[model samples]
Target: MTTKRCTMPFLRACAALAGVALIAGCASAPEGAAPKNSNGWVKDEVSDSYVFAYPLVLMDVSREAATGNAPGQAASNTLRNAQSLPPVGASSPPEPNLDTLVSTGWLDLGNEPVLISLPDTHGRYMDARALDMWTNVLWSTATPANERVNGLKAQTIAFVPAGWKGTLPARVKRIDVSTRYAWFIARIQTRGGADLNAVRRLQRGLRVAPLAAWDAHGKRAAQAEAQSGAGLSGDPVETGAPAARVAALDANGYFNRLALALEDNAPVPDDQHALKILGDIGVHPGDGAQLPSGSKDMAMVNAGLADGRTRVATPPSNLLAGNGWLWIGDDAGNYGPDYSLRAYAAWASPGLPTSRDEVRARVAQDSDGHALNGANRYVIHFSAKQLPPVRGFWSITAYTTDGALDGDAPVRIAFGDRNGARRNRDGSIDVHVSAERARGGSNWVPAPKGDFRLVLRMYAPKPQATDGSWQPAAVERQ
Candidate 1:
C-alpha cells in the first residue's frame, strides 16, 4: 500500500508525454529543485501503476495474438476447441491443464449479448467460466453460489453488456459484463488418451452465437451457421507464453497498450483511485502516452518497470503456504482493488477460478527446503484422512522448472483419484516421483530429467481444503 506523490520534474515529464508544455504543477515548485520525496515517490507510483495495468495489457496482447493475422483464425464470438491436449513439453500457457480438454473464445459484447450453449454430459464433470477484460470472473458454471451447475443439464447463457436493455429468451440465463469484451473458457474431464473421443463429442456440442442470431430455443436461426461445425477451425493460436511477452515490453509499449485497453474495458469502481495515480503520470483512458527519453528520465522509468515486474512475480502475503507449498485461494478470480494479488495471479495463470471451483497448490522444494530435482527420489504420502478433499477430482502433475510438460520423460504421467492410485494396507497412498520407476509402477509420476516442480489441483474443492484445516503432505526426499 505504498502511496504516490507528485513532484515537479515528474509533472514536467508527464506534461511532455501529454504534448503540453506546462501543467498546473509548474508554478508550485521551482525548476531544478527536487521535491522532498521526488525520486522515491515517482518510483513507487510508477511501479504501482504498472501492476494495476498488467492484466489489461496482457489480455489485450493475448487477444490480438488469438484473433489477428493468423491463418484459420476464428473471429470474436466464435469457439475454437482443442481436439487434443497440448503436446508434450508444451509451455505456451504456463502450467497447462492435463486433466481436461479446453475450448476457449473471445466474446464481443459491445453490440449485443453473445449466447453460449452447452450440452448435457449426463453427470460427467465439466465447467465453463467467463472473465471480463480485467480478468475478473463474471460467471462460472462451477460456482454453486451463482445457481450454476457443471455439465449436469443443457444450459444456455447470454453474456450481455452493461447498461444494455435487452430481453433474452425465457430459458436463457443472462450474465452482465462491465467490459465490452470477455473471455470464455470451458473444460471437460478426460481420463486419458482413450477418453479423447468422448471429450471431443462434448466439445463439439459447445456452441457460441450472437443473441441476434439465436432463436427462441437458443439455436441459431441461420441455417448456414448451424452447418459450419460450430466454429471449430484449425489449431488454436499459439502466442508463446503471454507472461514472457508482457515482461519484455518497455515502459512506452506497456503504457501505450494499457491506454488502448482502457478504452474498451472501463475501470471498476474501486479502480478509480489507481486510475487517478495513472492520470498523474499522463496515462489516460484513450491516450497512448509516452515516457520522457532523457537519460535520467529513461533510467528512472526503466527502474520502475523492473521493480513492477519483480513485485508481480513475487508471491503475495495472503498466499496459503505450508509444507514448502505456496498457493492462493481466497479473493481469487474476483479481485477488487487488490491489484497486487490480481496482477500476480494474472502473471502466474490468467483465467483462474474462485476457490469454490478449484484450488491449485505448487511446491518446488523438498521437505528440507531444497529445490526439487530428478536426481533425488521423493515420495508424497497421503494419509487416508488427509487425502485431497474434492467433490469432482484431484491430480498431481510434474513439470519442468519453467512450467512445461516434461517431454523427455519415458511416458506422460499424473497421479490422483482419476488415475487410480494404489493405497497401502495401512490406508495411505504413496506416490513415487522420480525419473526412474518405483516398485510396482502403479502410483509413479514421471519426473523431468532435471529440476522440476509439482502442481496439485483440487477441482470442486471442499471447504476444509481452503480453510487451512486440510493440506497436502510435504514431499519427502528418499
Candidate 2:
C-alpha cells in the first residue's frame, strides 16, 4: 500500500501558524505602530485586544451557527466513527442496542414535570457504557438482573441491568433528581421467552425527545467556519488592539451574544439581547416541592433546562463572548466519536488541505456495536518530513472498537518520534495497527476483540497545525 509520511521539522514549523508567511509576513508594528483607524487613537490593552478580537468573534459566531449541521454526521467523515466500538463476531453476545436505553431520549414535562417509562432489557438496563459510532452512548448487559425495580418510589431512578435477558422486578422504574442538561438512559432487562420484536420495540422506543431541532446544513456551517479563521471554524484577521477590547467587552457583558449571533432565525433586538435572557438559566430559589417518587437527577436536569429557557428570555454576556471568541479563534471542541483510534491526540479540522473524503469514514459495525471499519486508516496522516505540527509533543495510539485498550494489540503500544520508533531507509515511520502482531513491530498497539481506531496526539501545537493549514497523512492497511 502507498502511505504518505510527514517529517518532524516540517510539522514543527507548521505549529506556529507559519502559514502566515504564505500570506504576508509583515513584522508586528514596532513599539509604536500607527493608530488603528480613522479614530487615530491608540487602543488601551483591553480595548486593543478587543478591537483585534471583533472580527475573530464574528468569525467564531458564524462558524458555530454552522455546526447546527455539518460533516460531523456524514458517512465520509470518519473522524467521529472511529471512536466507537465495532460489532463483535456474529456469535458475539448482545452488547447493547444504541437506539435504546442510551439514545438520549428527552420528553418535555411541559411547564410541569412529567413521568417517563422504560422497559427492562435484562435485569440491568445498562451494564457498561460504550460510545457509539456517532459518539452516542450505548448500554449493554451480559445477564439481566431482576432485583427491586422501584422506579417510582425513589426520587432518582434508573434501571441497572445485571446481564442480557435478566429479568426486572415486577414494578421498578428509576427516578432521577433534577438538574439542567442531565442525560440518562435507564436500562431495562428483557425476558428470555419474549419475542425479538418485543425487544426491538424496547430499543426503538428509547430516545432523547423534545430536543432542540437538529442543525440541517453542516457543510454550509463548515464553509463559514473556514473563512473566519479564528474559532474552530473561522479565519483570523490581523486587527489591532481595539478588536481585542471588543471581544473582552463582548465576553464581559454578552455571554449570550454567541447564542444570538449564531441563531438560525432572524436577528434579535439589541435591547432584548440573548444575554439578557440567559442570566437566569439553571438557577432556582430552592427546591420548594420535593419529588417523592421520581427520577431525581433526570427531573432536576429537565427543570433546570426549562427554567433557563423560561426565566432567561435573552442569553448571557459571558456565553456570547465565548461564542465570539470561538467563532474567530478557529477552535472547536471535538464532540463526536473518534474511535479512540486517532493515532495521535491531534484532531482533523474542517479546513485541512486534504479532502474530507480522503480522511476517514465508517461502516455499519462489528458484533460489539462500535465502529471498526475505517474507510480510510490513520484518519490523520503525515509523512517523515511532515510529522505532526506541534510546539511540544506528538504521538499516535491505537484503540479497539470499544475505545478500550486492545487486548490483541501488538506490544500494546503507541508510536511517536520521541519514542525511538525506527524509521525507514527513506526516513519514514511505520505505525502498524491490527489484530495481529507486526514482526518487529516497534509501534504496534493492540486491537480489541472487534474493530479498532488510531489517534495521533500533538501536545502544545502551533497555530497552523491546529488551525488546519497542515493536514496529517492517511493510514493505509498493510
Candidate 3:
C-alpha cells in the first residue's frame, strides 16, 4: 500500500516546469520546476514571482535574451532621452562585398547546468563552428563533457558537459544564453578575417566596464528587494536571508538594466518596448516621456497591467550563465578549439585575421588536428610565399551540417607543413574547394551536402599575422 503525498511545492514546480517545456523544451529547465512545460514559464515565473523554480527559470531568461530587438529600433526616441553612450568603435572598412550578421536571440537555460555533446566530427575535430548553428546542448549534470548529439534530423543537438566547472565544450565555443531576469550581456566574437594583423587591430578596439561598480549597484538594488519582498510564481514568497537573496537579485537586476541600456545601435523602434522594462523587479518597457500619450501608449500600459502575458515573468538570459555552460560566437565557430571546454582564457584572442580584405567567408577547425567547414565551390587560395601564417600548424577541412565529418565531404582538406601539398613552382600554395575533392586528387577535402562554414587556423601566428599586416584570401565560390 503506497500513500500519495499532497504538496504545494510539488504542484507549483509541476505547473512551472510544464510552462517552460512549451518554450525551450530542448534543454534542461529549473531543477525541479517542470511537470512538463518549459520556456514560456521561466520569464513570467521569475518576473512575477521571485521564488526559485527549477529549469523554467533558466528557460525564460534564455528565450528573452535570444529574442533581441531589431537593429536601430527606437534610435530617434532613445537618442532624445539619452545622456551619452560609448563611442562607436571603428567600423570595418568596406570589403568588396560585406555579409553582415545581425545579433539574434540565444538559447537560454535558467539556473541549470547544461552540457553540449557532439562527437569530434568523426574525429576530424575541425569545423566545429559551422555545426554550432544546428547543435543541441543538454541542461543536466547527468550528461557528459564536450559532446553534441543529434535527433536523426540533425537539427536538434544534445550538448554533453561532464561537469559544472568548464565554460563550454572544447569543440564548441559560443552560443547566446540569457535568463528572463538577466541584465548583463555577452556578444559573439568576430570572425578571423584575411588580414591577421587587421583582425588583431580590430580586436584592440573592444573594451568592458568593471564588475565592481556593478556589484555596488547590485547591492543597492538587493537591499531594496529585501524591504519589499517580491513573490515567486505569482504568489508573494519571502526570501530567506533577505540580504543575500537581495544581493543575488541585484546582480541579476543589474544585468537586466544593462541590456535595456544597449537598445539603440541603428536602433529600431519595435524592440524598444522590452528595453524600457529593465527595472527594479520586472521589465517596465516604459520610458515615460517617449511613450506616446495617444491611444497606442495607453493601450500598451493597459496591456501590461491587465494581460499577465504582456509582463515578463522570467529573468533575463544572462542569469542563465550559472545554469549551464555559456560561450561566445568565436567558440561556436571553432576559431578557438576548446575555447570554452578547455582551459582557454586570454585577455583577447589570437585567431582574428590581420586585415579586412583577407577574410574567409567561412571556415572550421577541429581538435583532431584538422580544419573543416564549407569551402563549397569556394577555395581560399594561399599564394605560397604567403602561406597562411599559423605559428603552430594549419589544415583545411569540411563537415556535415551538424559538425560531423563526412567521407564524401567535398573539397581538399590539408593541414601541417608535413603533408605533400604541392607548393607551386613559384612556392605559392592553393587550397582548392569543390564538392568533388577526389577529382582534384591529393589536395582535395570532401564536403557534405547543404550549407557550410570554414575556418583557417594559424597557431602562434607571426607579428604580421597578429598585427593586421597579413590577410588570408576570402572564401570565394568557384
Candidate 2 at 248: error in angstroms? 36
Rank by TM-score (best first): 1, 2, 3
Count of clashes in candidate 1: 0
User: Which structure among the candidates has the greatest lDDT?
Assistant: 1
Stronger candidate by TM-score (1 vs 2): 1
Over the stretch 196-254, how does candidate 1's per-residue lDDT look in tens digits?
Answer: 88988888788888888888767766642431223332225444456678999988889
lDDT of 1 at 160: 94
Per-prediction TM-score, please? 0.88, 0.29, 0.28
* Candidate 2, residue 112: lDDT: 24
Deviation in Å, model 2, residue 472 alpha carbon: 1.7
The C-alpha stretches of model 1 lying farther than 4 A from their native spots are: 1-37, 145-151, 224-240, 292-294
| Whole-structure CA lDDT of model 1 | 0.76
Residue 34's lDDT within candidate 1 is 43
TM-score of 2: 0.29
Model 1 per-residue lDDT at 225: 42
Candidate order by lDDT, decreasing, is 1, 2, 3
User: Model 2, 111-229: lDDT tens per residue?
Assistant: 22222233343422322222111112222221121122222111112323212233222343332222111122233222223332454444443322221111232111222211111
